[model samples]
Target: MGILDQNIDYDRPVKLADGVFWVGFADLEGRLQCNPYLIVDGDEAILIDGGSRPDFSTVMRKVLQTGVSPRQISHLIYQHYDPDLCGSIPNLESLIDSAELKIISHADNNPFIRHYSVNSPLLCIDRLERKLTMRSGRTLRFFRTPYAHSAGSFITYDETSGILFTSDLFGSAGAFSNWRLFADFDKKCLGCEVAHPERPDEHCKETASPCPWSGMHHFHRKVMPGNRQLRHAMKVVKAIGATMAAPQHGSILYRVEDIAAAIERLQRMDDIGIDGIADAASCPA
Candidate 1:
């Protein structure tokens, strides 16, 4: 059966791969939902982009459901300094209560992340050669995607699972009514028709539809700085050859085709960030 046909319990941790779990809270009422992923390799656990303070209880509950204790989480990897990702660092540290626990992030984000009153040692990804090796010999490589959304923004690629934990690069915002963990698309959606045959150069902008591309397009234009930064980030994603993409704020792109389509759409997207402002300013009031 397809993933949508499966009976998924959102309250419990959803397994994405052998040791990777989606520990995010699925809040249907929220416009933007945060996705926090947990990677348990042997006895070592890593939390990627742990959600905000208000989401701690729900996020923690899901994490615990994965059969991994808070203490098992040796590293909390923050892709950026956004509060949606790093706001609960102090809370997590308090629960884990271990000096060995480290908060891993880019050096550019460390200074801002420290404002959370984090007790764990802040380890710069650059200092670690941009890779983290788990006890089971599994590796996670970090790729910097600056200006995609934040100056220190980066993505984590799990070598074992080939899952890319993208921060905000592939995030979407308008799927609340029909929210699903995995991307769902119509047969004629932009994702399916990569060439845009029916619409002919006009990209999908209907956010209410099941088309993941529409929501993704709407999100990138608002969050990412510009098309240049987004294109640069897409290049990194293409080079990584990730089989799946799990973003911090949207449905996970599990299929290879969906991942590729999302990357292409972003690469071609225009009127983002400053360009968007410039376009709006040029329009007659």
Candidate 2:
């Protein structure tokens, strides 16, 4: 995939299926953007991850366009507590009555809400035993994947559409418009680096530090940590045939078969000494 670093046009309500849609935010040169999903069914709606503070305006407008009231948003699922994933919660709640907002996140992430997620309504599910079915029939089954990309993290799979809303696991760079399946982007030569005028290649390097969105500190202390978790996640996703991978940042993938292939290739690289620890800054949202 050829990497195109250009300003992206923010679009609303890109239909993914019968009840699933993507609300996107633009970044420099089509490289970074916030990806928030609106899962709607009749009178109920669930926002997978709230966008950045600035993107909430677009999100609110989009939600209203669906003819659903602000109070109709029944759930806010935070795949992780990253700022890009849940930063706009406080802002969003201020506009809408979040009294009914059910904040669902990994159990390990509940405590990180020093101020952002503290007072709002929430449901933190730390363990996964059975599949969770949303009112829209979107089934979510999670696999415990500690420290795959973040500590106390888990990747969720939707059984109904076979979509995996993986939070930062095996993520890459691409603007909202250029995003396609993993294979499509890779074949087109798109890497994670989004070009900026002052520092075009600055986001390429990988480093270890605290997570900016959640103030979560991280270190490379585990032995083969990312690889181990990635391998296990691949097996879990493969068993369920996950077709699309929707992350907090960049692209709503529709290439399931290619995603499986990418998993294998990533594993093989791990065996060859390609450490999975990425520079946190390289994570564009």
Candidate 3:
């Protein structure tokens, strides 16, 4: 079924790969949607960026729909310390109730993540050699994308499924009214003509047109620190050679071509984060 099919039930766990599931709450009215992913390998499961406190029940319900109990979750990987990603830590710990459960993240973020009163032992990925090997022999690699949006930002690449869980690096900000789960760009969009009809000769990296690029541009310009940091993160993304990219918010880039297009667009684009602030520096004192 198509990812944007309205008939498709969003309440249930949507399988992205063999054992990978999107167990997030589809808040259709929210402008910024959060996506929590579940990677089940054998009997053990890993939850990535579980949503906020208010989203706990819905996210938990979808997690349960995957036939994996909360107890089966062996780790919760928080890419950063954002509340939208790990605010439900206490609630999740209460449910999982397993002493073996670990909250995996970069050491830089542990201090901030602890503010949520997470009881599970924080497993610093940097100390663990930047990788997690499941009992089933599935290895997940972590790459630090520092200052992409946070000091401790990182991306998780599942070697088994070739899916990169890019925290906020490739995230978009599309309103739920016309939200799509996947970045399925049309033929005209791929040609860049649709994105820049008036200036077809220009190398159109982004546009005001209605497409995934518009949302991506809007998000990166607002959240990313600068072009240098964005390029640094994009380099890691390219080096990983992930077949698909699942971000914390917005649509998933399921197509390899779409993923490549996104990387290319982000690389050439400029004026992000602080640089995008036009009149802030001139504000009257």
Candidate 4:
């Protein structure tokens, strides 16, 4: 699937909101980054998505060091079932108290969860039907845009801070480390842009092109959304005023500009019908 490209040192937490932190994996290149959130409110904490494959323990250790014990994590929310994002669920559950952890997933994720980890708890939500609220005063509203990235794929919106813990929706390339916190991201990302990119085969001739990122298929590919669904996701996100997108990979984009731009681009492309089970091709940098 995906190689262990870069290893991010979980030295300290990168604060995304007052009670939230970016606790996922980072890449040296600018192509993709996974930014799972560690949110602490009152005495309890919640992990949005388990980090990448290699860094699960580090993520667990970092979460425990918050003075909140392993049993303190109230919830483990899965935006979707992509292995890059949710691969650590089985391992994490073994280390922590599963009884205390309520795993959250969209309603359509039940069957997949049964196939992957039958013992794990799955809390599904119908994006078109209702919203789920966390005890920390954060309201998680879902938007079902299946096949946008994955069949059961959905986007979760946090109403409290205008943040969307989007799984794979609006991601960029590059990994942000401790030395390059959110503050220095602008400068660090500039250097990363030259060295690290989403895809490089674009520069090669059509026949000569090779897929360096074909490995990305282990996760989910970037499938173009239908005109109707694209417009709907765009309108909903803009209406919600999503200030920052905590994607499953890469550094967080502060504004909705990039996501908005992608929506516009998708609309211009030839309209494609949803197959419910199709893969999105390699994402461009």
User: Please, what are the lDDT tens digits per residue for candidate 3 over residues 87-118?
Assistant: 89999999999999999999889999989998
lDDT of 4 at 239: 63
Q: Note the residue pairs that clash in candidate 3.
A: none
Better of 1 and 2 by lDDT: 1
Cα-based RMSD of the predictions, in order? 4.2, 8.9, 4.4, 8.6
lDDT of 4 by residue, 1-285 (tens): 111122434465556676777765445444355667877777777788776557787677667666667677777777777666677777777777567677777776656655546455677766325476667566668777665555677777777667787676544332222213232122222212121123522322322322212212212223434545545555655666687766676435564554454445434333344322345344343
Model 2 has an lDDT value of 0.57
lDDT by residue (tens digit), candidate 1, 110-203:
9999899988789999999999998888999999999888888899999999999999988886747667888865545644533332222243
Tens-place lDDT per residue, model 2, 108-187, is 77777435845675565644353466775667777666666556566677666566776665554423343442223443
lDDT values of the candidates? 0.84, 0.57, 0.85, 0.57
List the candidate 1 regions with Cα displacement exceeding 4 Å: 190-208, 279-285
- The lDDT of model 1 is 0.84
Q: Estimate each model's TM-score.
A: 0.90, 0.71, 0.90, 0.69
In model 4, how large is the Cα lDDT of residue 74?
A: 75
Native-to-model Cα distance after best TM-score fit, residue 74 in candidate 2, in Å: 0.7
Q: Rank the candidates by TM-score, best first.
A: 1, 3, 2, 4
* lDDT at position 203, candidate 2: 23
Candidate 2 residues lying further than 4 Å off, grouped into runs, are 1-10, 127-131, 136-138, 174-225, 271-285
